[model samples]
Target: TLNKKLIEKSEELKQLSNDLSSANENLIIKDRQKDDFLDSVAHELRTPITAIRSAGEILADDDDIPLDIKREFLNNIITESDRLSEIINDILYLDKLQHGEIALNIHENNIIETYKKALSPILHLIQQKNIHISEVDLLNQYIFEYDEARMIQLFHNILGNALKFTDEQGTIQTKLSEKNDFLIIKVFNTGKNIPEEDLEMIFDKFYQSKNQNIIKPIGSGLGLAISKRLVEAHSGNIKAENSGLGVTFTITLPKKIINNNEVEQ
Candidate 1:
């Protein structure tokens, strides 16, 4: 009986040892993957940086550059630099969030006001696309206490997506409504539809839809994942669904009335 017990114990110990070994291997693999991602980010950032740097150097040396040419060159430099900075900062911010180092500056904000403010910069894109925004509830004032900047970032990410996918002159609609103590905002776009199989993995980090690859946009494919994290940080929810035309992204934010102890009632 003692011999049989010893055999059983030895088998259990071996199994436990194997499990630990497997876990350690997985950790090593994950570390390698992270390193690869960082390398890819660095490589991607360099392209825009190179363009901006070359333009700046030329502008610095060429005193005889035509005024119009100089202006165009300067604009390209600014645009490329801005694009590079955004991509670098986004990756760094995502890493910070993942490592629990991101801090939020929470404040009271009106959702509609915030939306309006954030959308101002992209008005040109909206107009150029001729995407008509159909409003559902403009009268509903959604005031919530949260990280204002992150909320803006989340909205920008989704709206940027709508702009990217929607075809020319397609309609994109924004709806804000209240439901059971939550303020919900939905952005619906008319364009290529997401495949059923792709929907499940769309929110995964670095997971761009196969359709997206066919029409690749200038993004790291981390926008939706980062937006999702930002929303969850505010105790909110975000989801994407096929809009019968293109795609619809819905964001639910838990809100409270200003200077009141009671939640939205």
Candidate 2:
């Protein structure tokens, strides 16, 4: 009689365990569905935005329109389109990165060359803001093996962040140096110091410093998170530090010097 009772209890416990497992699985599925919904919404909105921006540009090209008004309208349309495109690309790239499919095409590229290439598009803004840029004993000839596109994106994010946060006429400096066996890239910006508590989570997905006043515009808060992923993909490291009464981000990439001159220098 006791044996039969023990068997019945074991069966009941097993059924309960299975039910709990099923519940947990359902919750995971629901969470994934929510993420999917958000991604779909972003994609749908991007289509209409692209179409509208293109139409606006076409209209602006009409010679009948006043040149000044046409120019202003054209600029507004392009700016809005670029912003939307940036958001959509970030989301889609992040989604692929999560799925382990973002390809890295690493090559031996010159650091200064890469920096200059990435800065070309934003020179106007830097000039308008009166942000001063300098390097720290940086040699223009250092080369490191890395994914050019990904590193460019990383540079754009870090420098772009500085541009957004720093006030007009603030000084921003970038430095590249070789330390131990790694190549270090540092971007320093004078801005509101990030709270100590928030610093720990600044690289977390959807994490943004609450101390950053809504100046100009803010990104979707995924830039740092995506930057971290790209750095790690190259077996590199990245971190933030408070310096010069401001904020600085330090990135270290593992050095695979492709030239004899690299180690000699």
Clashes of each: 0, 0
Question: How close to the true structure is residue 50 of candidate 1, measured as C-alpha lDDT?
Answer: 90
TM-score per model over all chains = 0.77, 0.68
The sequence of per-residue lDDT tens digits that candidate 1 reaches over residues 54-114 is 9999999989999999999989988887777778777777777676567666778887888
What tens-digit string does per-residue lDDT give for candidate 2 at 79-169? 6677667667877877776666776776888888888888888879999999888778566588778778888888988888888888888
Q: Quote the positional error of residue 10 for candidate 1 in Å.
A: 4.1
TM match of model 1 to true structure:
0.77
State the TM-score for model 2.
Answer: 0.68
For model 2, the superposed segments whose C-alpha errors exceed 4 Å read 1-78, 212-216, 257-265
